[model samples]
Target: MTKNFNIWFKNFHAGIVLKVDVLIPTKDPSKIRPRLLQVLKGSDWVGEIIIETSKPLSRARVIGARKCSTEWIAMFDDDVEIPENWFDSILPFIQLKDILAISTPSIDVNNVHMIAYKRVMDHFRPLEQRDAPFIDNTLIKREVLLNYNPSPLFYSEDELLYRYIKKHGKWIHPPSCGVKHFLVMKDLVKAAIIMEQLGFYPLYKFLRSRVAYFTISILAIGYSHTYKTMTFFWKSNIKLMAGFLKARVNKKGII
Candidate 1:
């Protein structure tokens, strides 16, 4: 499958250059460098894989996308797994719509709580209501991005991009399009910190609401016997409370 993907990628659309950019920022670049190289060596789709060591991931992705010489660019996180059919699903949206950007759904690895949270949130509100219309990392047109620089602000980049694309061109979301996000607990903590830094208080509120909803759903639904509902509730509550307090404190200081 990898070999076939490599062949298809190399000969992808003759007379037109389809360059895919994978931007990965890491504090310990040496650890992940070899893995990235191995993946690139196997696939021909990668045009210019930018490794911005010790930089913020959000900043690196925007910077890398800006520097791309391709008509289209796909930005991905390091901990994501890209399926061979990802482009196949994404291509139709690009060809059909006057699309400046498109986003896929992301599924976290074995994290049922995260999935539940996302599902419940989506049920109540559309992707646009989630601060960023596009939740997953995106495939976008270089020209569109060049016209409007996405915010370099830590967590608001996605939200800013969504607004920019909406103002200028269409942003599409396809159901079949998706990416697997291999998220550990640490990633969640890092995300919270980034959100705080970006002053995304509303997002923090939404997340807390989702966590609370998840806890209630679990209790009401009576799902899972081995899982400790008490522990989950306690942990989520603590995090939510702390986030709320911090947001309030920040708001007071600003005022």
Candidate 2:
């Protein structure tokens, strides 16, 4: 349970500005660093920029987060394009005593798998607060992450943190603070493989999320007449399920 506090969005004093440390966990910092710099240039709340190039992204995030000096840390993926006003837009959430973290939405996203996955997720959590952590562009407490430090897994580390915070308090999804994801079907597929390999993610949630997700995709294929779109959806799901099954088989030592 969180303690009650007065809303401070209106009382945002210009002189007493609170800055946030920005952490970008990516293997390709050479390419993404300048891009991130350009995107975050306009923000007043941005503090130190920590770019970690560790092999496993989760490990990189943990390293960068620990280096943060502010009360909050803004963790972003290498690929997404963040809105300039994002930090200020989510200030209301930052002021909330009950809030643990805030994940910004991926707007104007074109990827077939992401669109399909998010559409299905909408039914489950309509406020854009997903069942799994969407940490692509998120504002999180520095200490909270250090306390429940994410593992060095290639994937599903965000899920681990999500489950931990969901029990303790709220993780907000503010629609106004939007980002653009430049991810593909291949990424999710690889993530699924790594997720199974890691082996600690909740099996029930995985089964339920994937089952309902691809079921909707299959249903869409049967009913929809949009040839190009449905075909793309079909191909993406094939690779996705293939990765999952391959991971499953590998995990069971059946290969």
Q: Pick the candidate with the highest TM-score.
A: 2
Model 1 agreement with the true structure over 1-255: per-residue lDDT tens digits: 334234445666553434576555555565453543565546656687666553454456556666677667775555666666676667556654467777777766566655555665566665434435544457777677566654445444566567767887788777634567766454333344445655656765767665665565565334334255446655765665565556555654321
- Residue range 1-255, candidate 2, lDDT tens digits: 222113233235435566778998887776573556797866777788888887666667667778888877888887778777777676666556678788867753756544654555566566464454777888888877777756666556677777778788878887735677777334767777776676644678666655665566654443333445455655665666677778877776212
Would you list the C-alpha lDDT of every candidate in the order shown? 0.59, 0.68
Q: What RMSD value applies to candidate 1?
A: 6.4
Looking at model 2, the pairs that clash are none
Q: Model 1, residue 237: what's the lDDT? A: 59
Top-lDDT candidate index: 2
Q: In model 1, which regions exceed 4 Å deviation? A: 1-17, 30-41, 116-136, 147-152, 176-178, 186-225, 252-255
Query: Which 10-residue span in candidate 1 carries the lowest summed lDDT?
Result: 220-229
